[model samples]
Target: MLKVTPNPPVTEPASITDPTSPYECPDSKKFNEAAERALDYYLGPPTARIMAAPYCPNRLYMTNPKSSNESLLVDASETLGSANVMLNDFAALLEGTHRKTLLGIAQIVMLGELAVNQVLDNLVPTE
Candidate 1:
């Protein structure tokens, strides 16, 4: 029987101290400063910011109630009509439960539209 042998280990001695070294220890302070500067350069705001209350309901709150109410009614009416058309189109394409559900939705939208129309008629009382 022949015996197997492993390769010998190799070792390199460390370099002695030199006055002029190519690499030096990294400066964490300088790195942090550079990172902060880079972040500021890329992420800084374009314009001066005025900080206000985060939860400001008055920002878009309607000033005139009566005029806004009328406009809202008209918009609701239009939205309901568009919804009815879409629902009808979908109902035509669907079957069974889906068809029935869509038809139900269409009926509800129509009822809402009629209610809005009645409210408008009562509010304006036009001949």
Candidate 2:
């Protein structure tokens, strides 16, 4: 049997510091402060407050705030089907290395299709 799926290489954890050696084994307080600062940087809201929208935007965009679950699922299914078909068609047109790359992308699309199909299947009861 041939293995098509890729497997990640196993890795062993590295020691941060040697016990016998000096240098205080790196201060936890400093590490905690750095980690806290990083968390604050990422999680903190925008520092610059935008009080109002642009007076005249080039293009206005709006999304459906009240999309139903069924409608969303149907849309997802249709989009997935279209994407899979387009990807397969696009992949067929490619040659050599590009073909393999596109095929890998198609595999990802197929996985998404599978996931969506599974959700739909579970949500809708069969007669």
* The candidate that achieves the highest lDDT relative to the unseen native structure: 1
Candidate 2: tens digits of C-alpha lDDT, residues 27-118: 75467778888887668664522333445544455336587676777788888888989989998998999999988888898889888878
- Most accurate candidate by TM-score: 2
lDDT of 2 at 55: 52
lDDT of model 2 at position 79? 86
The TM-score of predicted model 1 comes to 0.49
| Candidate 1 pairs with clashing backbones | none
Models 1 onward score TM values of 0.49, 0.51
Model 2, residue 36: what's the lDDT? 85
Candidate 1: list runs displaced more than 4 Å: 1-54, 58-67
